[model samples]
Structure formats: C-alpha cells, structure tokens
Target: MKALIIAATAAASLVSTAALAQQAAPQNPGPVIPGVCTYYNARLLAQSSAGQAVETRMQQLAQEVQGELQPYATAIQTEATALQSGGASIPADQLNQRRQALQQRAQEAQQLEATRENELRYTLGTQRQKITEAVSPILTALYQEKGCGLLLDRESVFMMNPAMDLTDVAIQRLNAALPTLTFNRMPVPAQ
Candidate 1:
C-alpha cells in the first residue's frame, strides 16, 4: 500500500545518509608535515673521535699485558727447545708435565687477551651509548627549532640534493655542544 512504499523510501534515504556520513569522516593523511628530510649519522661522529681514543688506550694496554707475559713466553720457548734437543734424556713424565704447563700458560695468555678485548668492547659500547644519549636531546632541539619532520641516516640515503644535507649543520651543532676532547677521555656510563 502507500504506507509500505513510504516506509521503503524512508529506509532507503536513511541508508544513503549513513553511507554519506561514513564517507565524510576524516582520515589520517599519513605523517603529514611541512619540513625537509635530512640525513644524520650519529655513529660516524662518535666512532671518529672515540675510535682514536680507544686505539691509543688499547696500544698502551697491549704493551703492559705483553710485558707481564714476557717471562712466561720465554719459559715456554726454553722448555720447547729442551724437548727438541738431547734434553730428551729427561724423563717422559717430566717432559709431558713441562708441555702441559706450557699449554696452560698459553691458555692463560689467550684468556687475558680475551678479557682485554671484552673490556675494550664494553668501553666502546658504553662510550657510544653516552654519546648518543647526549646527542639525542641536541638533535631533538634542532629538529624542533628547524621544524624538521624526519631525520634519516646518511648511510641509508642513495642520493639527495645538497639542500637536504643537514648533516653538516647537525655535526657542527653536536661538536660545539659537546665538551672538549680532553673531557671525553674518561669513559661515560649509560644514563
């Protein structure tokens, strides 16, 4: 009847309005912001300076470790020479004992070297963490000040216009904000 047709039309109109309302809802545009993308490699800066300091420290530590092991090295060499020569007249048990002692000493040296390596690695990791922590705030400040949207690693970039290279500015700002080289000589723990 007429009522049934009117009801059908009203339902259709409500459905159409619901569809339109759904379509009209706002949607995210995906990271929309007005800013330039700049490449920044924080590790490169930390490594460049800290690497030199680590190398110097390692060299000194190596010399000290070597000096400590010099006597053991000489003793091992002497025992091996004795085994090779007529000193073989020495008892087999004694010879085996000497050889085992030499092996143990070598093993000790290896362990010491490993320990030093671990220490160096720990130092490097800690230093890098410290530098990153210190630089993060600086980078944030710069990013906010400049209204930068994204900061990418320089290494990841294939090619970019010179205008996109804010690395130099970042580096300069970081270096200027950092304490002097002498101050960086000490190891900094993670914050």
Candidate 2:
C-alpha cells in the first residue's frame, strides 16, 4: 500500500513538471519591425514614362512600315479579285500558277511582318534593359535608406497592406531622378 502511494506521488510530480515546462516555453509577442518587408515590380517601373516614350517611338516606326506596304497590299487584293472573277476563263495550270504567285506574295508579306515584330521585340528588350540598369542603383539606395530587410515582387504577393507598398515611393524617386531616359536607338541598315 505504501509503494502504491509513492508511485502515485511520482506520477503526479512528473505530470506537474511537464505542465510547468510547457508553460515556461518562451514566446514572442512584440510588434513586427517596420521597413523589414518591401515589394516592387521592376516591370512596372520600366513601363513608366520612359517606357511609354519607347513604345511611342516603336509605334511611329510601325506606322511608317504600314504606309510603305499599303500599295503592295492594295495590289495583292486587286489581283486576287481579278483572279476570282476570271475563274474558268483562266487555264487550270495558269490558275494554279497565279494561285502559287499569290501564295508566295502572302508569304513574303507575312515574313516582313515577322521581321518587323522581331525587330520591335529586340528594340523593346534593349530599352527595358537600359531602364533596369538605370533604376537598379536607385533601388539599392532606396533599400539602404529605408532599411528594407526583405524586398519582394509586387506580383508575387497575394495580400499586402497599403502601408507595405513602396512602389509609389520608388516610382516617384525614379521619375524625379530620371525624368526622361533615352533608349539605345536601333540601327537601320542603309540601302
């Protein structure tokens, strides 16, 4: 009966010790550090005023190309209409030949369009790189000044309080620092 009482006391002591240990565990209940979290989108920065200027220039170039190609496009349409109207009067072989010629012309037009697209992409990519390069030093300065411990992309964040957003500040700083940045002009080959 004494051994049973001692065993019961020991079990109670162990349980009490465990409960005490759990309660003694340390916890952090302090407020979070300000400026420790930051986020921005480099793409958005690139699309600012400087980026818009680059796009405007590209659009102008496209318009010029379109003007030059307008006559050819009209000629192609006219020829197609003529072929359609003269259908059976044209020999089968001749008709096939004309069709092939029209197909070739269409392919050429498509090729020109593809080339222009590639050129525009290259131009835009180069401009974007320039903008990124210019903005990086400013971003580094901002990070240092703001004491940002973690910087993330705006797009990657699911939810962020308005206070957490530094994009507007960055944009304002960038715009002030670089009001108008000229992109590297793409060289056109002389005919």
Candidate 3:
C-alpha cells in the first residue's frame, strides 16, 4: 500500500512538475504550488458522486449475503448438536451415515460462503471502476482548464492554503456532468 501511494505521488508530481519545469520552474519547489497546485480530499470526493450508489450497492450486497448465509450456520449447528448429543447411543452404521451427511452439508455451506466472497470482491471492483471512469475525465478537464501545475490528494499533504483546494469545485463539476451512475451488474466470467 505504501508503495502504491509513493508511485501515485511520483506520477502526479512528475506530470505537474514537468509542466512547470519546462517553463523555467524552481529548483527547490515549495510544499504548496504557489499559483497552480490544487489538492482534494479523496473521502469527500467519493461522497460527492450522485447518490453514492457504489457504496450503497456494496452495502446491499453484504446485507443480502449475510441474510442468506445465516441458514448455513443454522444447518451446521443443528447437525453438530445432534451428533454430539446422541452418536454414542446410535447404531454404528446410522452414526456413520449421519457423519457423512454432516460433512456433505459442510462442504455445500463452504461453497456458498466462497461464492459470497467472490460476489463481494466483484462488486467492489466494478463499482469502483464505474466511479473512476465517470470522475477521472472530469478531474482532468478541470485540471487542464484551470491550468494547474499540480494536483495532489489532500491525504498526502501535511498542510496547504485553503483556497488552493479544488475538491468543492471538482464535486460540483462532477455532479453536474454525471448526476447518477447506473452500474452494470455484469456476471464475472468463471475463473
């Protein structure tokens, strides 16, 4: 994760600094981009989207799985309890059958859980992709239109001038252009 952050910072810094450097920029740059650097809070930016639908959908998926998966728990518990309470008194053949049945049910429950997890990962990936697709262009257009020398996520910066923040501006622009995102529920191809 730290590597990822460093890479992103390096990339954003290169683009903005290179632009200014080409035009006779400073050797030792200031923390703030004096005239053209803009910063934004990532968390706030995420919420600015129409309906915050990606997050909402993710929550819905979790809830749906939770509700459905409860039955698996109940079934496993019942089988285990019956075995623990009476296996010693039962005929050996009957006991063996029950144990086998219990193992089969456990395998099915595990498969259901694995499916739920795959659904979760798929939902998160697609929802984020949808949001990024809609937001990136808008940010780029604003950055170019504003002629910013640099754009940095506010989370990376220690301090900056309040006026230099572009989050609000970006949010307004994004909302106007993409009022809502209607995500596609594409089935993930079997891996």
Candidate 4:
C-alpha cells in the first residue's frame, strides 16, 4: 500500500512538471521578423499597361506572320507533290528548273520564318527591358514600404501567406510609372 501511494505521488509530480514545461514553451508568432519575405505573381503583373500593350503587339505580330506564311506553306507542299508524281518522262531541263524553284521557295519560307522570329524575339526583349527599368525603382520603394527583406516570384514558393503577396500593388505602381514601352528596336548587349 505504501509503495502504491509513492508511485501515484511520483506520477502526479511528473504530470505537473509536464504541464509547467508546456506552459513555458514559446508560441509560433509567425515569422521571426514580420514582412521579411514577400512574393508576387509575375503573370499577374502582365495586366499592367506596358505589359498589356506588349502582349497585344506580340499577338498581332504572330497572327500577321502566320497569315503571311500560309500561302508559301501551300505552295511548297504543292511543288513537293508535283515533283514526287512526275515520272522520268518529264524533260530533264524542266525537272531541274522545278527542283531549283522548289529549293528557292523552301529557302524563302525558312528565311521569312527565321526573320519574323528574330524580330519578335527582339521586340519582346526590348519591351521587357523597358518595363524592368521603369518598375525597378517603384518596386524598391514598395519593398521598403512593406518592410520586405526579400521579394520573390510567387511561382517559386511552395506555399505563402496571402498578406505577403505584392503583385497587384506592384502592377498599379508600374502602370503609373510606365504606361507604354517602345518595343521594336533591339537593345545592344553589353560586351
């Protein structure tokens, strides 16, 4: 009976100690330093004035190039089909001429596609640079205002607090800072 009483008292003391330790444990007060990190969705930033304008022009250029290339595509296919079916009875001179023509046509189509791709790529590059230049200062100001130690693209994060997102606010500031971008010229790369 005495042993049982001692065991029960020891168990009660252990329970009280555990309860005290739990009460003394620190709470999770979110981040060590609030607003130390922030995230923004880049795609969401595309709704800005400069970004919207760039996107519209990019779409228009794509449609225009596709329209221009359609006829050439058809012509090349027709020429290829004709060459395949025309037997050796077709005069050697005529055959050579047709072959040369097909070669030239195919080259023209490739060159056109390559040129259009380069042009669009250059335009998009310039548009991005212009917007970045405009948005940088404004974004820095925002980061300071929000007490952000680090800012990152939301896509890079596994999960984040909604309060740490700065995309909408950044877009508004960027639009006001730069409403439009001159995009056609390729900027010279630094050596």
Instruction: Identify the leading candidate in terms of lDDT.
Output: 4
Ranking by lDDT: 4, 3, 2, 1
Query: Tens-digit lDDT track for model 2 on 1-191?
Result: 22323533554564465446537644742344576555555433444676556556655665666676677688789889989999889999999999999989988877776566555556656776766776788778877887888777755654445455566676676666666655443643445
Summarize candidate 4's per-residue lDDT along 8-27 as a digit string, tens digits: 35545644654465476456
Count clashes in each candidate, considering only residues at least 3 apart in sequence or on different chains. Answer: 0, 0, 0, 0
TM-score of each: 0.62, 0.68, 0.73, 0.71
Local accuracy by lDDT, each model: 0.56, 0.63, 0.66, 0.68
True-vs-predicted CA distance for residue 40, candidate 2, Å: 3.3
Pairing residues by index, what is the TM-score of model 3?
0.73
Worst 10 residues of 2 by lDDT: 1-10
**Model 3: worst 10 consecutive residues (lDDT sum):** 1-10
User: Could you give candidate 1's per-residue lDDT for residues 21-94 as a string of tens digits?
Assistant: 53764563234335766654533343334433433554454455567667767877786787779455879898
Of the two candidates 2 and 4, the one with more favorable lDDT, higher being better, is 4
Off by over 4 Å in 2: 1-35, 182-191
User: Which pairs of residues have clashing backbones in candidate 2?
Assistant: none
* Candidate 4 lDDT trough over 10 residues, lowest sum: 1-10
Winner on TM-score between 2 and 4 is 4
